[model samples]
Target: MTKLAHHLGCFLREHLPHERGASANTCDTYAYAFQLLICFAAKRMHTQPSLLEIDQVDAPLILAFLDHLENVRRCSPRTRNARLAAIKSFFRYLEYHDVSCLDQARRIQSYR
Candidate 1:
């Protein structure tokens, strides 16, 4: 289940279009968000993002990513918060749908 990219991409292509009529922009946004997530998690695990394991990403890692987005990326707080919101929502959806992300869903509550 560590293949978040393949899983998410398949899920989106198969279900999202039918369930929510997802737009191209929405798909692309989610893709980029996950890319950033993987990179951030990889940095925490001291490896290249492509070598990251999904288990390396937890609550603290997510917070660090948000911080990096705000401080290093120089993104506005509002934008950072919005991306966090989106990430939280995605995990929530994953958990609710019996996806293998329940261990990470609780981190959403820690998000501001």
Candidate 2:
């Protein structure tokens, strides 16, 4: 399994801020979405978020995360959509850095 920290760090530190020129609110929202995703993934995988892999964030898992956001966390559809957007953005960033993730990124892009 590929380590998640490096890719996520790069996306958050460089890609979003420098490349995407995301605003402070956008960054915060994306960060919040990821924070929830990582925590949910850790619980589902029975491991720490730091040990998660890119493959673990597949469409099925992301779908479940979105469900959890709405059902368990009581988030609105708009918030759920926003979170998915953040995930999609992150996956798009990953595709340029990791070709192996191309299919995965495409799947995510087609999910919604």
Candidate 3:
């Protein structure tokens, strides 16, 4: 189980700024979306966000989170899609560092 903290740090600090060249607003938005995801996952798993494993963030959970973003949080479809894009980006990063999650990453990328 790869540590969410380390990978997240690399994504935010190195990947987003350097590799992707994301703007400040995009980075902030992605950060917020991930913050929500961590909270949601931690609550569901009865564990701390720092301890969350890659395997814990499976497709079913992601689908549920997206639904929650729309139905519960009242986010617009555009907002939901943007959040999904951020998640997909993170999963893509996981593809290289954590091949164990390649199928999961592909599944997320192919999500409608």
Candidate with top lDDT is: 3
- What lDDT score belongs to each candidate, Candidate 1 first? 0.70, 0.91, 0.91
Better of 1 and 3 by lDDT: 3
Clashing pairs in 2: none
The sequence of per-residue lDDT tens digits that candidate 2 reaches over residues 25-80 is 88888998899999999999999899999998888999999999999999999989
Compare candidates 1 and 3 on TM-score and give the better one. Answer: 3
Determine which window of 10 residues in candidate 3 has minimal summed lDDT: 1-10
TM-score of predicted structure 2 = 0.96
Error of 3 at 52 (Å): 0.4
Q: Residues 21-112, candidate 1, lDDT per residue (tens digit)?
A: 77888766766777787777766678876555544667888888988998899999887877786677567666766456676777665678
For candidate 2, the lDDT comes to 0.91
Could you estimate the TM-score for every candidate?
A: 0.75, 0.96, 0.95
lDDT (C-alpha) at residue 7 in model 3 = 88
Candidate 3 per-residue lDDT, tens place, 21-57, comes to: 9998889998999999999999989999999988889
